[model samples]
Target: MTTSVSEKVYRRGPFPVKFRCLEVLRVTPITPHVVRITLGGEDIQGFHSEGADDHVKVLFPEAGKQRPVIPTMGPTGPVLQPGEKKPDSRDYTPRRFDPVAGELDLDFVLHGSGPASSWAAQAKPGDMLGVGGPRGSLFVSNDFDWYLLAGDETAIPAIARRLEELPEGARAIVFIEVADASEEQKFSTRANMTLKWLHRDGAEAGSTDLLNQSIRTLDFPPGDYFAWVSGESLAMRPIRDYLLNERGTNKSWVRVTGYWKRGHADHVHDSKN
Candidate 1:
């Protein structure tokens, strides 16, 4: 999940992140609406993704182009070459990173007519995709009395990764909302976790109170807990406020992010904590 441009969340990384021009090794369908694109090559060397919630910007060149014109790390920042088409780009979670094999798996949700979704729908093996940053890793410690994780389909990659990385015998509570049962995913974790699946059925995404309502009804585990919440911007606002105002959760330990905002063409992540 991306932190709001305005908030200071926990993160660490080697600055001036490197860029990699990856090739699509294979494209496989993970679900009815989700696809896993496996990217690898010699360029993936030295790739480091230590946080479960790390995200990279995927650059898509114009149709029929072999690769996008990627920028270099300039003395100041990214130095874009002159007179070149800037390809479309979007942030996505790194589902799996195998440095030994030089492979990085990214999951994409195909729901909109946006460039990223459209590209994934038609992508094939040997296709070129540019990736940059992560710029860093949001490393939330697993050392807590318990953990609460909640979000929609966009947040699944991070949520699943966190569950898998938690120590054995640790306690976790998870809630995920999606289109229906078909969108629900199975997660394997050694942590003591209670997972709940909420279906929107026919309701429009980001136009309901399901997430907030669920959090209010559940009897949360006691003691020091780190809560991570992300999804539609409007839907996340109430939940964040409730946790801070009503629950009195510590500001430093809580992270609430809007992976995307409704009614906005570009999906920008924003957070209040």
Candidate 2:
């Protein structure tokens, strides 16, 4: 596979990456379609997730099972018990982690009947959720003249974190698409930011070009800019190509990803920056 901008930024880590099992502390709804699950355990003491776009693999147990088969990290890699079936897993952003509280917040998009989604829908306090490494962090410097952040609902957690982390006087232009007007959210940021929200209305998720179309109409600010985008894989391709080929975004400063793929059962959103 070719190296992407994110890979260059994160590289092979000298950073510590460990797998930890977190017990659910609370489950809250952020939106009609988004669930915020707060988890905590002693295992979170040294948890490290420093990037706005960092992700962890969340493991879910088989139906009727009481717990996920959490793996123990071995010298070679994650090691499972003999004859134990591997659990279903999906990638998710670490929305927030409070070391003092030993708590971590992960937001899940409840859009289907998939294991992760189904698990989140009925999650309750005391449930154990297995989470593994972000392995490394791609720390995008906030030193750019301006920034561009775009994505669909699935990308909201990352987008929200980035907006909140920008320093005072920084500039960020954001574009996000959600199901409808009710899905819009307000973000707190010290940066001079402009947010544009797109609505899919009645259109099927991952089947519309709202994000691409919105970005296309923007009169972007001049100067060196860092762009971070992700959503459905195919939906993001043209946008990534546009930034790299048409807008001349420096390959090193732009990051694009496919958070999910329409019609695909698995959600492994790899970067294509």
Candidate 3:
């Protein structure tokens, strides 16, 4: 990757690790289920993200009101009791950023049930919300030589960002699993990327049927390559073993995150075990 003033990025590599209130400047529906929102605020000027297997938290306004009721302080952290009158929070990927112009774009999956998804479904102009990220990044150097990237829609933004930032001649295979063919979208990039969008006609987001089939059939060539996989936390188990035990992948080169679990909300992974 050559240096160019116009193509420079400040995000050290994903996780920025700070929270700020940003106002919604605009929202555009890219598809029937994918909505993109443009946010602006002075606080956004300092954000930087690597956008590879990374995500950010989006604090939403109350369901029935403009302002949320989450307390700045809590017994544990920033949480309230059940049935609390706090605004909902969702995780999303930074689709785009323009630090110089004080603008950041976040794309949302307008699925039902989830607070962030429902809010984005009905979100309108002049809405205000809190945005935070740059928590830090998971890095995989060109050391592997080749790479394999796979995940669900929640992983698409980061996957696309990585593709665009990869070295021009980098050899990589990317698989984005989606609900149906209609949900598919092209990811623009300069790297030699082979993007395969897999659609599970009636499958849910966290299911492993399609993801498992896809990973099991992959043809691993002879080379020191790496893999990055995320999505349903539970489903990643088999793939983790395949890469770590079967393929003999380097721990440093593979980043497999269980972004979400089947029965939990605001989920995360503590220890790799």
Q: Best candidate per lDDT, number?
A: 1
Q: Residue pairs in steric clash, candidate 2?
A: none
- The digit string of per-residue lDDT tens for model 3 on 56-126 reads 77788766776444434344446556776656676677888777787888888877778888778877777
Q: What is residue 131's positional error in candidate 2, in angstroms?
A: 0.4
Error of 2 at 17 (Å): 3.6
Candidate 3 residues lying further than 4 Å off, grouped into runs, are 1-17, 69-86, 269-273
What lDDT does model 3 reach? Answer: 0.72
Model 3, backbone clash pairs (residues 3+ apart or across chains), number: 8
Where is model 2 more than 4 Å wrong at Cα? 1-16
Clashing pairs counted in every model: 0, 0, 8
Rank ordering of all candidates by lDDT, starting from the highest: 1, 2, 3
Q: What is the C-alpha lDDT profile of model 2 across 1-273, one tens digit per residue? A: 223345324443535556677889999888888889999978777787778888898888788765789888788877899998888888899999888888899998888799989999999998888889887667777778899999998899899999999999899999998999988877889999988888888999889988888887788888888889999999889999898999887888888999999888776877765
